[model samples]
Each structure stands twice: as C-alpha cells, then as structure tokens.
Target: MFKVLMIEDDALIGDMVKMFLKEEGFIVTRKTNGADGIEALSRFNPDLILLDWVLPDMDGLSVCREIRRVSQVPIMIVSMKNKVAERVDALVAGADDFMSKPFSMHELIARANALIRRSKLSIGTDADFNAPTLSVSAIAAAPVSAMKPAASVEVPAEEKIRLDVNTRSMRVHGKHVDTTYSEFEIMKCFVNHPGRVYSREDLLQTVRGIDSFVTERAIDVHIANLRKKIEDNPKEPKWIRTVWGVGYKFIPM
Candidate 1:
C-alpha cells in the first residue's frame, strides 16, 4: 500500500480525506500542523503528501520548501485560497500539485493517485505498480509510459533543449535551468511533440490535475517563467511561441 502524509488542520476535512483514501487502499497519516507533518516525514517516508494552506504552526508553502530540501516526494496542496497567484506560489514553493477546498473527494483521490504514479515514473521504480482506473476528465490517470523523454523523438542537431527524465531536470544551451515540477511537466509535453499547439486548458490539464481550480491564465504565468529561463530574449521568445487566440507551442531551435 502507498503511504500518504496529509498535513491539514481542519478536523472535518482531514477525517473526511483520510476515510476516503483509506477506502482506496492508501495508508494515510494525518497531521494537524506543519511542524508535526515535517517531523513525521523521516519516520513515515510517505510516497505523497497532501497539505493544507492554513496550518496551525506554519504555512503550507514553508512546509513545502522544507520538504523539498530533504525529499522529492510528490506534494499536493489543499487550500481554500484559489487565486491564480496563490496557486502559482504553491507551485513555486516546490509543490507538485494543488487542490482547493470544497473540491469533490473523488477528484482529490484521483489527483493523489496520479501524483504518486508520476513520482514513481520519475524515479523509474514503477515497473510493478498497478494504479487504479479513474473516471476523471482532465486528471484521469495517465498510461504507464506517459512520461517518456523526448530523446526518442527526432529533433534537429542544433536543438538546444535537453530533458533528463531520470533527474526530472531540463537544460538549455548546455546550462542547467531550474524548473519547478509544473514547468517541467509543461516542457515535457511540449518537447515530446514539437509544434503541437496546446491550449491554456490543455496545458492546465497537463500541469494540474482533473478540473483544477487554477485559472487558465495561470498557464500564461508558467509559460512566461519558462521563456525567461530558456529564451535568450524573453521579450522576443524563440522557443515557446504564442498562437494568439489559440495557445502556446514549442519551436525547437
């Protein structure tokens, strides 16, 4: 069974989530504050974490950063604050995904399972794992080999972008570019199929899970952040280009 550490202060929410996840065969440990959550990290060694924005001790963002310093376990922040900037802040703080309160318990479980699957894929340790079938629109569980690197795709010899799936890292022009999990997922989808137009909703589905609370415009923010890192001049981006009314696509150099 996969272990999950959920750091949420609300007794009702925490109990509800625990009950549902338990039914799904997950071994869930619930903590009411960020400090206890962090303390349990070493002991529990959970495969995934579900965090709350308003913890009694510290905020979810701080707990997220603290966990990132020690482990790469996938984290999904559950919060009542659903603003685009707030969502982006959670992602920037090293969260792998985010979920807003008042969300359906069904969607939360699906997203949680998806994160665990993705984490196993990134580490190449999912040869024998079997994920449950989920009936979600945007956050449906992906195929086993859905995250294959773009190395298999034929690109030009002058291509400057490289992705290391094992390390979950991206490099541009022979230099390493720091990418959050969200940025990496977007780039992974882009490079695997160069020039394929992905609408904001499409990218949102790619980064966040089924029926995510993040606004489509937040995709614009993630794209801008990527442009600043990989593009020589973000003002006139060369790699990722906007399709105006449509969305964005990757243009290999």
Candidate 2:
C-alpha cells in the first residue's frame, strides 16, 4: 500500500481527507502542523505528501523546501490559495503538484495516483530509461550513449552533455552539474529532442505531467535556471535558445 503523509492544520479537513484516502486503500498518516509532518519524513517515509499551504508554525513553502533538501518524494500542495502567483510559488519551492481547497475528492485521488505513478517511473530500478514513455525519440538512435552504465562512461570534453538515468545526474562538458528535479527533467526533454522547439506549455507538461498547477511562465524560470547550470553564459545561452515569440529549443553540440 502507498503511504501518504498529510500535513493539514484543520482537524475536520484532515480527518475527511484521511478517511477518503484510507477508503481508497492508501495508508495515510495525518499531522496537524508542519513540524510533525516534517518529522514524519524519516519516521513514516511516505510515498507521497499532501501538504497544506497554511500551517500553524510556518508557511507550506518553507516546509516544502525543507523536505526537498532530503527527499524527492512527490508533494501536492492542498491550499485555498488559488492565485496564479501562489501556485507558481509552490511549484518553485519544489512541489510536484497543487490543488486548491474545496476540490473534488475524486480529482484529488486521481492526481495523487498520477503523481505516485510518475515518480516510480522516473526513478525505476532499471539501469536504463524506458525511452518510449519519456517520448525520447531523438535520442532513440543512440540509446547506448545516452543511457550508458552510470560508472563506466567517461564522456569526452567535446561532448557538451550526458545523462545517467540511474543516477538522475547530468554532466556538462564532462563536469557534474547540480540541478533540481524539475530542471533535470526539462533538460532531459531538451536533450532528447534536440533542435525541436518547445512552447512553455509543452515544457511545463514535460516536468509536471498533465495535472500540473503552475502557469507556463514557470517554465521560463526553470529554463533560465537550467541555462545557468548548463550554459557558459545564461544571458546568451548557446544550447537552450529562445525562438522569439514562440518558445525555446535545444541546440545540441
């Protein structure tokens, strides 16, 4: 059974959500504050987290960042804050999905299931990626090079980038590059389809899946951050180039 750690302040809402999830065969541990919820990280080691934006001690964004420091567990922000900027803040703070208050229980369950499934597929035990699921056709011709044994491959300096599906790591110019989960996903998509233009919406769906809550503008933030890590000059990126009013595309070396 999938374990869910829910951090919600309202007792009535917490009970309702827990009961609903339990009915769906999910094992849920509900906490009324951010501190206890954060502690559950090691104690419960849940498969997913359903976090409330308003907490007794700290805002949900801080809690989200703290959890992200140690775990990549899928987080769904359950908040009454429905504004676009608030949703964008949650995504930027490392949340994988978001749902406003007074939401449909059925929709919440569906989104929860989707998040868990996607997380499992992303970090599957297999040594190589299931490229078809990721729509990685451009790199399909060179699967060996793109998904090589994590430890054995030593990419030459001339090679601008390399990906290790097992480690979820990226190396640019033969140097290990540190990237957030979203940034890495975006980069993976770009590398897979070199030279293909991707609108912000396309890139947003790539990282957050179909149940994404953030706007397309959030993709711009992710792309800018990615350029900083991978490009020699983020201001005038060489690989991730903008296509004027349309969107962005990757120019593989």
Candidate topping lDDT: 2
Runs off by more than 4 Å, candidate 2: 125-160, 171-181, 208-210
Q: What is the C-alpha lDDT of each candidate?
A: 0.77, 0.79
Residues 147-196, candidate 2, lDDT per residue (tens digit)? 43233433444665777654566777668775656777888777766777
- For all predicted structures, in order, the TM-scores are 0.71, 0.81
Q: Cα deviation in Å at residue 178, candidate 1? A: 4.1
Which lDDT tens digits does candidate 1 get at residues 105-175?
88888888878876776545784533221111111133435533233334344447776666666667657
Which 10-residue window of candidate 1 scores lowest in summed lDDT?
A: 131-140
TM-score, predicted candidate 1 vs. hidden true structure: 0.71
